[model samples]
Target chain A: MEDLFLKLSAILTGFDDLDPKLGSLYYKELMKASGPPFTALLQTFSSKVLGHAASTGHPASADQPAPAGNPEDLLRENIWNVMDFQILSQAIINLWYTATLKLGNVTWVAPPEAYFDSLLWRAIEAHPPAVSGGYFGYWRYPPEN
Target chain B: MDKNYDVIIIGAGVAGALIADKLAKKWKVLLLEAGEKGRERVELVGSYLTATAQTLGSPYKPVPAPAKNMAPSPDGTNDYYDQPPGTENPMVFKSTYERRVGGSTWHWLGNCPRLLPSDFKSNTLYGFGKDWPITYDDLEPWYCQAEKELGVAGDHEQLNGLFGAHRSQAFPMNRIWPSYSDLKVAEALQGAAQQWSDFNNEPMVLFCTPQARNSVPYDGRPVCTGNSSCVPICPVGAKYDGSVHVNKAVANKATLSEKSIVTRITAAKDGSITGVTFIDWDGREHSVSAKLVVLAANAIESPKLLLLSGLANRSDQVGRNLMDHPQGEGLCVSREPLFPFRGPPTTSGIDKFRDGAFRKDFCAFRMSMGNDGGGRTQSPANVLNQLLKTDFGASLRTKLREKVIRQFRISFLAEMKPLPSNRVTLSSQVDDAMIPRPKLSFNVDDYTMKGFDRIADVMRSILLALGSKPEDLVLPNHSTPFLAAGHIMGTCRMGTDPNDSVVDAECRSHDHKNLFIAGSSVFPTGGTANPTLTIAAISLRMAQSIDNQLKMSQT
Candidate 1:
């Protein structure tokens, strides 16, 4: 189930280079937030990828993304219109981008060590607000892309 | 804590720390803090990273109920402050202050643009706010002294004769080099300057901001590495905070009592300060005596202390004329990719709008270019949240990077006219220390409203000049109109006449000779500047006066 969660996360988040250790923590948190529904969502996500590969006449496992369809459309097809798939996908994105989980108004942040590891800073070509480790006046030049 | 001391300062903020550092050399000084000593830097950084809302004061320690044993933010949900009735929509004081040993300097943006000469005599020149008793010339020398003490870095040539105020010396260190985004905005504004001629014919300059953060290692602290978190927490000690001077004072043999909340300042019938009673960490009340007392407890807390003790309000001006450089932002996506999230939050601003002859009609304002990318709008975070709502996979990555990197913003800090109607008083609700919380009734006047209109008009012109549409400008909430910059000036104003003011030119209480009140509370009128540099200068001047008096008494 955890392996399936990682495979789905890679496809859903669009970043295949995510740290597996970080993925493990996120998987646990997703289940913690939505226990039975999370398990159900994982099963649905796996079958969609596997079934898509079969229908497309491509050899694919749950580990392999289909050559044709995007993750958003695959999820949105039959069962995805419901809010469950949308919320779960958003939660997956939030876990990678902000290292946070929101059930309602309350947002639960991951532990401190996982803070600087967020992909949000990576996407923006900037470090987090207070955690910049670069030397003096380094911002004078454009960030190294 | 000791029962008696040569001097007892009620707050351990920048003003208190500056005074303590000076006075501790000769007189035995005791600095009493309502909040505990500062928490670890990494702890604060971690808290800021984890905070969901990520408000200004969220990084500080709030578990022990923060200051005087209460929750961190006093203005969080209007639970701490008493806003009068009929204030449901129109007026609310949005700024808040932290109460740790370092005071609100912990979360200050560290942008220290000095007040212009016109700021000192606004009433005499513009017929707007009240004139300060002391002139810019009188405070000029002290400003230089303060820059050295605070280790201010600046490009002196850029702001040499800004609005007719002269600098006696070069800054202690060179200015923090402008960020790449700052240069891009500067180039855009140079093109935009010709268009601003219709609004105000004054030449718009993109001047590098003078800041207290070290450009090079001046004091023991390391140089700034563009942490870009100067407001919440400078992960490294590159930025200057009040705790720096507090350490200096303690090293010089001054006493510091943490988790000690001063409740009431006692006085004799003759109106001389006798002593003060405080509640300690264990909820034990203790009274301490001092030959001299300085109130560096910020604008709100200082006035609340005076009102609590029924002292220093002889002019009925203890808690009147509350003011803040209420700020508004104009967020825009630049035509080109100019990466923000660099160098201290802001490194450059326009001094042309800082002062001019237009003050007779509307209040003057300062224009600052934000390098933090839609700061109050919470750029990268808000952008990511919006993207994640529908976008995922490759599209998500592409949208997030494109939107955040090209994102830019320009914010204005406008001067608010002093109004007695906007004031701070004692609330019916009390803190854990049994002291009443501060109540505020704040609203801007027509003069400030007119200034906002001008600000919007000028912003539109600048956008057009940058080849951007006015529609791209994202302003603040019109209902609130402005976000509090936390200047918090006035309330206990200083003037020669005791009839309408709380303190004298020397910050000596008109009602009590031994009592001296420091901090922005003594600012009769704050111009468009951030008020910290001026706060340091005035506190240094007040310390000089007190030092001379104490020396004379010993002789």
Candidate 2:
């Protein structure tokens, strides 16, 4: 989940500056496409980031000990029960960056050059076109000639 | 005959409501309302965000539409009164009055004050316009009647040299306690009233203006909670609305036909009104008949109806003498925040400048304060956008919140002398039904501007004396032009002579024997006070005259 978030966040940031045609095309693609294709790519990246963080045995979730309650019961709660849309949006963005910092020491499968400045974010950015412009900088594009 | 009516009262405003309610108790009445009853409930009055969309001031908007004029846009989703994209007349001024049932009184701030004695004889003294057929003494009892119905609350104690108008009885309930901020400003003016002596110099005085809204529960309504949403709707029903009277009148057998837009009052060959033809909201034409006709549609539409009916040109004065209490805005700085954000609607007033043998053409008064947030009271996004105009990013939100909640502001109400040329007539453009629009031609005179400046200076000095900083002063300038206070008056003025007046002293039109004009339309001169009290008084007088006429026919 962590690696997946990181890849998604990075991909969104690349479109911060883009050609208008490409931006519009990307915006349209995101709307037409479904989750699984993106999900497989995100799952691979998140696992790498999460594995690196978990190995340190300092999971951010571990710092705040859970109250005396059944773990299974807590898991049974709906994902929405924990946070509303606004808080969830902020949390996703923040968590992605935090996971990146945690996994900074790991040797990424694709290597820093092949992935960091290139692959993951670019793929995600191009995957989704924005509607009414995207959140943050992902949807914006330079004026058409 | 198309049809005939005993009386045809146009407009469904407070004035119209009173006339219909009174006359219908004895004689047959036909009340015509151009707009629907629930318009304010669904369209004008809603959540702050939704209401702001319908209102003139909103955060999402930099400049909200002007209050009146203009038609529906191409989409027909919005009716921007100030400026429409493709209209013959584009410029807009702030005169927001609802054409719907109960009229603009639905959005009134509930500040009801009587016109001063001097206001009655302005023509005799200053040689302008016509004199009221009835005197202050004649309408005094009527003012008392209106106050009771409105459930006003006030000090009623003496102030300055004038004792104010004598109330037949005390306010329905005790006066509202002034807010801590109102108290501070009131204390400072206590001394100024004495210093300005001659005007304040009279032997008697009245400190505060009586209001139509409740301070404490009276009759059946609750006291005002100071929502400051008085210009729109009272969700709690604390303020008086003319519709409340209309409802009662209906329950007591007064016929109400909502969405009935009267096209014209058709008259017989003998010049007597035979009936009125109207189209309802669904485009169905209906004719109503009675022996008499009453026009209470307000200064603009009342004249418009008469003109359309061909009853206007007889005296050629139906829409000729249009007038309003020429209201303008002025600013003064205060050291301490007066908490303008909170209040009972308008408790105190300064009559220090209401009259004088000294100031030839000027009369002014101080109304309660209003909040002037530095554009922050707008929406979060809007404030951000404005801040983006000046600066960007992180600091914008913080600064916007601080500015949006300004708490101290006092407004002054001044009256412009009656100008005959400033009238409401027909424009070339037509409505959805092809009827001409009301072409309003008006301008504030230099004399009134000087009066506004002087009032602002006095207010500033008083604020300064009360420990306000001179640097925080908001001066009266053209940046904020004094818009119409919506207390439309004097269009069809009353006079002793038939030639100069549309209605005689009794509010009976000089030209049409069976036609009567009620409401502020017959006001000879409106004082620097809200016209509701004066309007109620005149309606009460007209009711008696109407009853007398009905009785004479029987005899």
Candidate 3:
């Protein structure tokens, strides 16, 4: 679970060094929030990417010791190399951004906390306008870099 | 259960609230709202804060029973309004309104431009569409009263002669300061006008918009703090909404029953409205008898009710001649960092094309400049995904920052001509309460489309002058065309001819003497302006006429 969490976090945030504890909590919450089908999809996506990394002479196996240097770079490279992994990676990225698990036309709205933690806000450097941003006039200034 | 009242307003939106606030002082006025009584301002603000997709309806919670979501439904099924097969240009007819106590105003942007003098005389001057029963001069005083009531802020001098509207008084408050993007755009346009003759033309001035949001603390509301969330919800009560008047009406002794959706309008044999029947959330039916009935239930719902109850159809115009401001937008990246998305969603607009001989050929349009920088484009996860595809590391972060700061967008809302064929009828599909849903058939005619085509060029020119390349301007085409501006109008249009219009000069239905209608639904023609201010002004005028008639009958 920890390996899968780190691998998924690396794909979403483009960083493997993200706080492991926080990553694990987000992964657990996301799995619960996304329910069974989507969580299974995420698990499959992580294993495939990690398996590809293992074949590429990298120590990405769960039983193997933590690989030297950036594991995210290897996973990201494998993500772009494989077509299905790329699609799944994009879907996982979208899951963080929209906080929804969409299968065809059906969608399950994610919990508010998931939306609050969406990396989309972090990428844009601004909180959702009416949501968690500060008081009335806080938006008047450019978001801090 | 049956209850009696001096007057029963079918909606608790701005129109009904304004009318009830005035009439409740001397009469027993009842305001029936279809949805839940809205929460306090703070609760709405909180909802907006946590909302995942902060679209127009984000702040307010939707009613539990099936209703339209503001954003387009994924499966192309109508959630709010049902559009049947064979409806022309049905995709462009999308609109969503809150059924809550405050109605759509809870999600309104608070833009309050008055209709031009020519708007009332469109048929007489342009030889198309029906002329309004009343003129701008007739409603000028009422506009001032409405502005005062709504706490409108504006630069009066900038608005002078823009559309030939004569104001009897200045705005209630001074204009909100323009954002950096607005100032940069205005400056760029000024420079471009020197080189381009079209920019110097009459009625083409870019100026501060008169808005209903407060620029200063007035009427017990705080000044707008540039929340940039005005459309979905105003975090503070700085923006004017129907709830303000609704609360005042209740305070003035008007009775309000929320979650009571009026389904039928009963009338006597002589075509005089007797009472209305409504169903509560619990599925219990109730009836309210009134001396006078005012149907302020918005454009679609009011006409749907009339068709359902089989009342006010003397001329067969209850749900005909539907109109809305069909709009197209352009996105551009400025060479300089304009830093959009800091202030209100919009602060200034270009109105030179609002009126002219150009109307003889096609529709006129208003170019509203947005201040949200690239916020609209960048905020969407899909668009951001596209933007982030090129870079993966720190380069991705740099690209995001650069693109967001320099992005600018503007939209053109073209005035659509009223067509009887473009109408709202009752759908076969019924809700849980068994009320028939409204099915709309709408199409933007060649006249409006030509206007859209013309505005595309103007939009591109403005973007180019603002430092965007011709290739960089993303303009709409036929395949991906104008969207609904949510200013639904002309369904129950008002005019001098009772045979052609649903209501008379005073907005009193020709068939029912004691029945009145309010809101944008009664507009004879929708001009190139937002319609809420006009809705308020017309409601105030109707309230006065009703008061006078009641007093005369008493005497």
**Top candidate (lDDT):** 1
Between prediction 1 and prediction 3, the one with superior DockQ is: 1
lDDT of 3 by residue, A1-145 (tens): 6666566655555544555555565566556545565455555544444543433444355665443445456555645445554554555555555565443444555555655666555655555554434443444355566
Q: Which candidate is the best by DockQ?
A: 1
Off by over 4 Å in 1: A51-82, A104-106, B63-77, B85-90, B194-200, B476-480
Better of 2 and 3 by DockQ: 3
Residue A112 lDDT in candidate 2: 21
Write candidate 1's Cα lDDT for A1-145 as tens digits: 7877887777666678888888899888887778888887776776675453433434465666553575557766633466877786787777888888876554679976676778888888888777787989988899888
> What's model 1's lDDT at B304?
93
The 0-to-1 C-alpha lDDT of every candidate, in the order given, reads 0.82, 0.56, 0.75
lDDT of 2 by residue, B1-555 (tens): 224456677777888888788777776666787766653342333333232143532211212442422221111112322233234322233464666667777667788767777667766765544567777778877877888866777666542125345555666666655555556666666565435443544421225556677777666776666554566565456778788777766665667777677888877887776668888766678888877777788777778778778784556777765666555443443554443333443456566576665446555554545433221123223433454343311233334334333224556777766766666677666776556766665655566776776666665665565564577566565445665677777778887787777878888878777778888888877767788878877887787888888788678
TM-score per candidate, in order?
Answer: 0.95, 0.72, 0.87
| Model 3 lDDT tens row, B292-336 | 999998898889888998887888888988888987678888887
Please provide, for model 1 over B177-206, each residue's C-alpha lDDT reduced to its tens digit, 9 standing for 90 to 100: 988988887787776665454336765668
